[model samples]
Each structure stands twice: as C-alpha cells, then as structure tokens.
Target: MERRVGEQYRITSKEIDQYDDQGYLVLKNVLTEKELKSIDPIFDHFVAGNESEKMGKDFCDMSQPYGTPIEDFQLVNAMLPGKYIPSFSKNIFYRIAKNIADQLYSNGKAAMDYEQFLAKKPTKAEAEFSMHQDLGYWPKTKNTWTATFSLALSDADVINGCLYLIPGSNKETELRSHRPKEYGTATNEAVNRDDSHTLIIESKPNDKIIHLPVKRGDVTIHDERIVHGSGGNLSPDWRKTYIIAFRDERTIAEERAIGFTHSHNDEVDWNSIIK
Candidate 1:
C-alpha cells in the first residue's frame, strides 16, 4: 500500500534519546479523541470477526481456542486481522503507524512488516508470550531500523498483562540466537526462554525495567532487539492490543525475508536449529 503521509510525525529530542538508549518508548494519547472514536468500533468489529470459524492463515488468523492442549506453551489465541480487516489498515492508524516508521527507519522509508491483535482471554493469565527479540526471529530483515508500535486498544495494565521491557537492551546490537520453536498458534515468536520476562544486567551502570500500564490511546514503541513480553490477563474482559510493525521497505521482500510458522508441527524454511 502506497500511503502518502502528508503530515510528518516528529518526536522530541528527549523521546529520541529515550528510544535510542532504552530501546523502547511509551507515548500516551497518540490518537486524538476523534481518531480514537474512529478506531474503537473498527477494532471491536475486528475482534468480533475473530469469532468466525472459517478464518484462514492469510486472512483473519483466528487460532486455536484458549484451552487447546499444549506441552511447550499455552494455546495462545491471537489473530492478525490486517489483510482482511479493512477498517484498521485503511484508517488513520495504519497511516500514522507507517509515518512513525518512516521517520524512525534508517532509510526514511518503511513498509508494513506485520500487524496483529494479541489477546489474553479472561482468566488465562499465562498469556504465553515467551520473551524474545523480534529481529532474532527475522534474520533476513537485514540490519536496519525496525520498530514495533503496540497500540493499546484496551487498558493494558498489570491486570491484563501490560508490556514490559528492559532499558538499554538495544545497546548490544547483535541479534542473539533464538530458538525457532512454534509456540502453538501463539506466534512465530523466536524465543530465548532463559531471558523471558526478566532482565539481569550486571553493569557499571544503572539498570531499569519498565512495565507499561497504558490506557486505551497509548502506544509503546520498541526496537526489534529489545527483550519484551507480558503476563496473562486476569481481568474479566479480553485484553487486546494492536501491534503494527515496520521494517525498511527493502528488507521485507520475499527473497530478503524468511517465513515464520506458528504451528509446532510446521517446519521453518531455513536452518534454525543447532546440531
């Protein structure tokens, strides 16, 4: 989709420093009231559409139900509604996300890497987001500035497993080896199980961890290498988040990019295991 972002989204020097140093930044009320209102019903509609049983992998990817039996990870229930959900990709959110990506990407031009709605169904607090860096999974994404903007559609707090990230994790630019295990319809998330959900850094420097209890209109943007994950939802309502990720346009082509699979039985196209 060729989108013209007439108005550029500019961040302050402080925000840039935060993102550069900490590998993550949280911005509140990114969408105005009108935009929020526009997005609300559209997001609701997408969530409702996830209830259909006929969603395919390329379209609305409504995965296994919350109670699917799994030994490796919880049956993670999620949906990537971007390809089929017209309202979201056509609305202001898509444009705004791209604009932000365009501004942050080293090439100053970006393409949509992916979009997904991660949900933690009520009472299943083990949301099963095994912690890992995004770039580790996407080895072919090439070295460029890629970022993920996770916009909060619902209140993502401790109750609903809000995002948590470690500061300055991006200082180490090397992409650590990630185990390419399919977490059972959870995601094609490359995982470093030992580093999941915790950050232990012994440094001659200060260390910080941030837990975002973001409101409806807030967003958390993080670099592809930052260690990130969230807990499960203990709340009564479904905890849903809208994730829009972008990589440099040149990095996402079929040849440059590798396919990620979400099923345990599915095999990755390239070599991912250590002999």
Candidate 2:
C-alpha cells in the first residue's frame, strides 16, 4: 500500500457512498513508512522547538476560556505548515489526498484549501475538542462541498484522542446553532474573542456517536458539515495528526470574501498570543 509519488489513490464508489451516508470514511495505509518518516523531522523541528510557539497556539480544551496558561494547554496546533516548510506542501500525501478528493467531489476536481498539525499531548485529560461542524467556522455558501483528510502520524485510539463523529449529521440543510464553547449564554450570534478559535454545537443525549481509531499513516476523510470532535489523550503517548482539506476553488473564494478564515491562518500574529 506504499504508493509512490504521482500514483493516485483511487476512491471506490462504495467508499464515496459510505461517506455520503455517514459523513466520514477511513482509508488505511495511504502513506508508506518512508513518506511518514520524511515528515518526522518537520514535526520535531516545530514541536520540540521554540518556533512552535511563534507559529502555533497552545490550548487545553476547546470548551475552556481563552488565556489558559501555556503549561496547562494540553494540545498544540500549528496551522498551514506549508507556509513555513515548503516540503510539507510538496509531500506525496498532498497529491494523493487531492486525487482521492477529486473522485469524491461531484465536480471531479478539488483544490487544496488548508492544512494543519494537531498534536494531543500525553496525559492531558482535558484536551478534548468540543463537538462542532466544520461549517460552523465558515461562512454559508451555496456550494458547501468540501472534504477534510486527516492523516494519522501516530497510532490513534480512544485512549489517545481519536476522532468521534455523529453519523449522518452532514445531511442537515441548515447549520446548527453554534457558539464559542466558553460562552455562558445560549445565543447563536455569540461572537468569539479574537484569541479563541473554538465554536461548539451541543449534542443531544441520543445521538449516535462513532469513534474512529486508525493506525499510523491511515487517513480519515469527512464532510464539511459533519458534527465531529476528538477526545483527550489520556495515554502516555502523543496523538499527532496532519489534516489537509479540499474544496471547490469557487467556494474557497466565496468564503474568503465574507471574512471567513481558518483558525490557524498564517496571517495571524500567533507569537504575540501564544507567548
């Protein structure tokens, strides 16, 4: 299953149907050992160095208020690494991801919308991301077709903060009410502080939640409207994930016009906030 450069990862019709019905799908062994190894130094250089603080944000729980102490922050997220490390965008994983996305998209084409690194630190019980849909963080557009490909850089399991999503949640025509997780009032228009990046939708007690655990190099793809989140890394090991998202080029431009930007945008002065 070690695909070479330029080799496409074909998506079967059955896989596409499943994604349509369930809002998420997992593809195993999409990256070879060599490809995975090639990313090691990049992750190390950022995670183990002071530069990470300058380029990324550290937070505890998405539900917590902003300004949590740095040492108490259980998750470290660096967005758009390709901006600083050109090799990231040049990786074979991105090409294969685009290939797969092309097959899943109705238009038969996709563009690289954004990418990021999310690392759950070991033994951080409060590191969980609150339940939320990707669209919750974006502006409403006529064509909401987009896919996020999350590649596991470390073995992901329940103990180590694997993704959990609600089945068929993507079918909702209207966006659910979402507010910054720390907001005290129940208002759909609750604006998040400039420093806070998380918005959450409250899940009902009867929702069917599915947790997806994958081995290193496996990738999980999900729709933009899906209600999803991950748990804390209670294990003694890190749960590292590299996420790349694809969308129609037109949709990208439409969303940008409405002042919508990803939380980990390179344009932000993250160093001022994180430090």
Candidate 3:
C-alpha cells in the first residue's frame, strides 16, 4: 500500500513549487549510516551471482553484458529483490516517499515500487550513463506526470562519475517537439545534457543530492522531464545505487495500460511496474 501524504509526512509549499518549476530537487543526507547498512545484506545477496572485477577500485557490473549469449545477472532487475521495497516495517523508505509525496502533491499519497540497479562502478571499465530523462522511454503522446527516485548506495563525486545536470533543462521537450529519433544522440540526456553550463552533484555517504552525486540512501525526487545522466566512473571505487519509480494513483490505470512491460521469474508482469 502507498503511504498517505499528510498522515505520513509533509512537504513545504516552497519545495513543491520549486520542484514543479525546476523539474528536480536534491535532498541531502536523508539516510543515516545505520539505515543504509541495514540494506547491505540484501544487495550483497543479489550481486553474489556476479564475480566482482578489480582494476583501480572494487566494483560490480550491473549493466547488460557486451555481446554475450549467456544470461547476465547485471542486466536483470529481478535478481535483486526486497531491498527496493523503499519501506519495510522499520525502514525509512516509506517515510522518505511520504515526504516527497507531500511536497510534490498536496494530497500526499506515495506509491512505492521496485528497485533497479545494484550497480557498481568498475575501474578499467569506467561507468557511463547516457544523458536522458526517464520520461523519454515512456509513451510521449500521453499527457501525464511521473517521477523516479534514485537512492545512492555509495558516495558519488566528480571522480566517481557523479550526475551532471543542466539547470532548468528539463523544460526542453524531446518527445513533444518533432525531431529525428536521434535528436539527443550526442547528448543522450541520460548520460549528459546538450546545453551549456552543467552542474556536477558532489555528495557524501548518506548525504543525498538529487540528480547529482547520487548519495547512498538519498532519495532524489525528480519530474520525469528532468534532463540528467552521469559520466563514467573515473574513481577507483564502485558506485552502487537503487532506482524507484512512482506516480499518482489516479494515473495508475493509464500508466499500466501504456507503459512498458518486464518479464520476471519466467512470468511477464504488465504495467504493474509503472505505477
């Protein structure tokens, strides 16, 4: 069940208005060391299938393997489960979501969902995420609002390939404006922004920054339109993070009908992941 807005938490009018206009917001240190450590076992259990590689830093691969006929645990979100529930009975995820909901919507209903990526930054293979917004992958014809929350499992900095953002660039529409499918090819928006003047998010462990150095346990509340992505990890350490998507319950049905589907544990789950 989703948490109630006012009942669980509250967001100031100022914060809500800022997110509405800017398309993204960064909340620092939303998680404590104790809170983050509680999730370590779940993450380690999931990544146990993959062999960690050593270069300059200790990291694990979470992305799809290059040219392989074998099953890559890195590409499968289903392999890692339960750690993403956001809020367990004593966990803070639900509380975090409640606060976000209260700020984003006065009505205050936050729906928690799956966790994606138990990613690790590798040394030899620098981690690189294409510049793009979560909204780009969804059906563009539909007029609606959705948001994704990314919780960092490790400290991210410029050397660690922290997230880069073009302030207010979320206002630009890739799906709305007519352009070649490759419009954002160079500036994928998922990895890097196309506009000038980029902002690099520098963060500390348990100290979260939205759309920037995705800090461990720092919940990033972003409008689907936010133009953001991170460069490859240059540091000698791996950066691990979890991503969750949520939206208003009113749009739940529509999101399910048109959103992408995922196959899990030999069964196909449709539209359930979107809401």
Candidate 4:
C-alpha cells in the first residue's frame, strides 16, 4: 500500500504555499550518510552496466546532443532500477522519499507514479539538458499536477552540475512545444521568444535562475511544469540523483497535446529529424 500525506513527513503549510508560489522547494539533509549508503549497492549495479555500455529497457543511454549515430552518445540514465534490483525499492531511502512525496504532493494526497535515476559522469561534462518542462515528455496522463522529487545520493554542487529551476515557470498550465529528442534542440519557446536580446543563451539572466547545490541526502521538489535542467558535471565526483515523480491521479491535461511522442529514448538518427 502507498503512504498518505501528513502521516509520516512533517512539512509546514507555509512550505507548501512556498512551493506553489515559487514552483520548487528544497529540504536539507533529509537522509543521513548511512541511509544513502544503503542505496549504493543498487546504484553500483546500474553503474556497472552503464560503464560497460549496456543499454536496455531499464539501462538507458543518453544520446549525443547532436542526435548522431557516431561514437559520442554513451552517458547512461538507468530507469526503474528498483524493479530490476528489488533491494532498491525496499531501501530506507525509498520509504523516506515516498513519505515525503505523499506529504507534499497534491495538497498532501498524491501517490507515487514513476521514479528514475540519473548518474552524471564526470567526463560527460558537456552532456547537459535543455531547459524544458517534464510534462512535454510524458504521455497523456490523468494528472497534470505532478510533484517531482530529486534526491542526491552524492554531493551535488555547481561544480558537479546541480539542478536549476526557472522560478514561477510552472504558473502557466499549458505545455510548451518540445523537440523530438534530448538532443540539443530548442523548445518552441526558445525559438519564439523575443529575439531582440538573445533571449535564450547559456545560463542567461543568471539572476533569475535558481541553482540547487545540494549535499548528500538533500532533496529538491519541484512542480513538473517548471523549467528545470542541470549543467554538465565539471567536477570529478559523480553526480547521482534519485528522482521520484508523484501525481494527483485525477488532474488531467490532454486538450493541449500536440501529438508528439518522440523522446530521448527514441532511436531516430540525426538525418531523420525534420529540420
């Protein structure tokens, strides 16, 4: 059975309102070093597969931003590892994370929908994600309001490419047009934004961008519609993040679906993309 809100986690009403207003909230040291260590064995298993270039349904490899068939696309993103490694689902980290999601999502009533893990290799410092909403990639879901939790298994600082959010970006309930793949294509917003000032550039308007440099056990929750992405890992430490996504189970958004299902996992080559 799933957990309910206000049962195990203690979050102030004010904090919930803060998340509503700013589109994100950060909880400090939600797990201890020992708690994080309990998850290491599972992560190691995925890492081993990734290091060996083993790509599969669960072990997903990040494609080169250019969407080529060349030798560059090798960074790995392991999905639903808990399903493959049962110990991962039963770990203390999962329990604490689930409890937190149960408390903060859907006015403290949402349930767990999906979870994934991302390991940013130190050498893949150039493999950064474009600023876009998670909703753009997901299928027609019954819930539109999703609470995404990102827990850092290792220390994530600006040097190691920590996550960042565009404050209040989720206020618009409409889904923006996204490119076909995680390749370096810009969203419709990027293409249509006012061109007078070079609207979208690397870390542009640095003042408005919120960089999340969290430590081990730190968790950051953000509205799924918020424009969030991370920099490339320039540091030697591996940036490992465990992500849990929660949904209201009823908030649906299919009216604006533009009918594109191509995502990062699609095996389309660069030449096939309609430029």
Instruction: Identify the candidate with maximal lDDT.
Output: 2
**Which has the higher TM-score value, candidate number 1 or candidate number 3?**
1
- Model 1 Cα lDDT, one tens digit per residue, 58-130: 2221222222333222223334564555445646777777767665655456777677666566677565465
Candidate 3 C-alpha error for residue 106, in Å = 3.1
Per-candidate Cα lDDT values, in order, are 0.59, 0.76, 0.49, 0.62
Superposition error at 219 for model 1 (Å)? 0.8
List residue ranges in candidate 2 displaced over 4 A. 1-6, 53-69, 183-191, 263-275
Across 19-107, the per-residue lDDT of candidate 4 in tens digits comes to: 88888988877777777787776776776564333334345444343223324433446666655556557456566766766666655
User: Which residue pairs in model 2 clash with each other?
Assistant: none
lDDT of 2 by residue, 1-275 (tens): 33333558877789999998888999988888888898877875665544545554432234355556655557766677786667567577787888888888887357887887778889988788888888777666778788999999999999988999988989977777776556454664645445467877898888899999999999999998899999988999999988899989888887567544564432443222221
Worst 10 contiguous positions by lDDT, candidate 3: 51-60
Q: What would the TM-score be for candidate 2 when compared with the true structure?
A: 0.85
Highest TM-score model number: 2
Q: Comparing 1 and 2 by TM-score, which wins?
A: 2
Ranked candidates, highest TM-score first: 2, 4, 1, 3
Q: In model 2, what is the error at residue 149, expressed in angstroms?
A: 0.4
Instruction: Candidate 3: give its CA RMSD in angstroms.
Output: 9.8
Question: Against the correct fold, how does model 1 do in TM-score?
Answer: 0.72
